[model samples]
Structures are given as C-alpha cells and as structure tokens.
Target: MYYGSVGGNATFLLNLPPDKRGLIHENDRARLSELGEAIRNTFRTNLAEGSSAQASGTMSGHQVDSIFDGNPDTYWCPEEGTEQVTIEVDLKAETEFNLVVLQEHRYSQRIEKLELEVQQDGEWKPLWIGTVVGYKRICWFDKVTSRYIRFKITESRWCPRISVFEVFCG
Candidate 1:
C-alpha cells in the first residue's frame, strides 16, 4: 500500500497480508500498479520543485549548501589519482554547522571505511565514517560546533568520486 499528500508528501510500500493477497483478484494487480505510479509521480514532482527552488538561488547559501555541488577538483579518491578537493568553513561565532558530502562510486569494486574529518586545533579529527558498497551514491552529513570544517575520505578499496561538497551554518 502507498499513501501521500503534498504538504506531508510521504509514500510507503508494503507487502500484502496473506489473507489480503489471497482475496485479491488477478485483475486488481492493474489497479495496484496504477496507484504505485501515481504515488511515485507525486514524489518526483515534489523533489523537482525543491531542487528548482535551490537552483534558482532563492535559498540562502548556508541553508542550501547541502544541495550545492562544489567544483569536482575538491574530491579525492584513490582511483581518481591524487585529485583531492578541500573546503574550509569558518564556524566562528556560529553555534552549529553541517557539512554534506555527495559521492558516486561507479567502479565494480566497492569502497571500505569511508570517513569525514574536521579541523580542530590545527589538526584533523574524524567526525563520521561508513562503508560504500557497489554502485552507490553516498550522501554524508556531519554536524558540529567546531570553528573549522573539512572532509577526509579515509579509505577506499576501489575509488571514491565525489559529485559535490557543501557546508551549511546555523
């Protein structure tokens, strides 16, 4: 079953209960398919609208930083051959901030031990870490109160190619 509304646009997929499945006529599959399509279209529309607003620059740089794609040069994965991009954000006087890193792993090999780091006291410190498996698009979000921020791709068995990096302040 699926359900959604514009203001609280949400969709859920669930397996039919055994009793319900047994009761459904073969022809009912067509109606289920139609409902699935409608819910998917609604989600697509909402996503497109949100993306459009961010691209239009109506959103503040800080608020929309998660959606911003920084220069490609700012990323470094072993397969990318020494290409590393670093962004430094000053959080002076700010109580909180977030860093969003988007990466695409397209190689057949998987990446292991992905991590993000922040600069503290002139040293790099780990903030978060994870693993990337197969052809996955990884979005990493880190929230901190430090005065400086940066990202570190700690480990990769294949290659880590990032599509974008953005920092937001709050």
Candidate 2:
C-alpha cells in the first residue's frame, strides 16, 4: 500500500501501516520502480550544486552550512530578534537558472517577505519578490546568469529570526 495525505493545517505525511495492513505484494514492485523513477526525474538537477552559502548572522549552534546540507532536520537560524537577514549563495560561475527554492524549518512561520536577487554589475538586482508561508516555497522567473544569489529576508515573524532548512536555485 502507498499512503499519503495533506490536511487543512498544512499537514503532509507518507506512512506505512502495520505489516499486514500495508504490505506491498510482489506485483507492486513494478509500480514502486516507476514511482522512484518519476521522483528522480523531478529532481534531476539542483542548481545549488557546487555552491557555497553565507548568511548575515546565525543563532548559536546553528550554522549557515546547514541550509545546504541536504538534511531537513538541520536548519540555519538568524540571531535572535534580528530585524533582517540576508543569505547569499555563490554559484561559482555565471549560470542560467530560472528557479529559486526555499525550504523553511518544519512547523515554523518564520519568513514573511523574501527577495531573490542576482549580482549584476557589482549590484544586486531583483529577480523576484513575494510573501512566503508553510514549509516550502518555489519561485520562478525569467532565466538569469550570475555567479551569486542573494536571498534577502525583508520581513519575518514575531521572533524576527530567519530559519530555513535548504535553499537552491535551478
């Protein structure tokens, strides 16, 4: 059996019931293989590859590196009570990409307003600006070539701390 659900309160889950209740019969192997392939194709490329990130500030014991470590359990949080925070990613070289993905810390409403920018002529130019909520946000815009990406948190929740699990451009 394959089980998943989303609820009114931003709930999402994938679970397997008891052995007898959720058993995957031998015939299901083919279906599972197809599902696996679909997932692989969906994430075939991650533009954040070979990139390095830096943030304006990080809360004690939480480092900026956690944001790109591919682990949702780890996160990057700005200093307590910070008014604004900027996290920058160096793409190593100019590359064309149209998507910026931000995954926030689970169960937290931290980011309110975000601005996506690229370094152009030594100045940061806007690519997209919008409000964000929930655990994930995907921003799409016209493709741009730049070596650096600046993710600015212009507004945040009451704590005023910016916390995120992962950020990428693709």
Top lDDT hit:
2
Worst 10 residues of 2 by lDDT: 1-10
For model 1 the TM-score comes to 0.39
lDDT of each: 0.41, 0.68
| Candidate 2 C-alpha error for residue 167, in Å | 7.0
- Candidate 1's C-alpha runs over 4 A off are 1-95, 98-101, 105-110, 133-143, 166-170
Return the top candidate by TM-score: 2
TM values, all candidates: 0.39, 0.70
For all candidates, what are the clash counts?
Answer: 1, 0
Give the per-residue lDDT digits (tens) of candidate 1, residues 84-125: 333343434433444332444233333444455666677888
Error of 2 at 13 (Å): 14
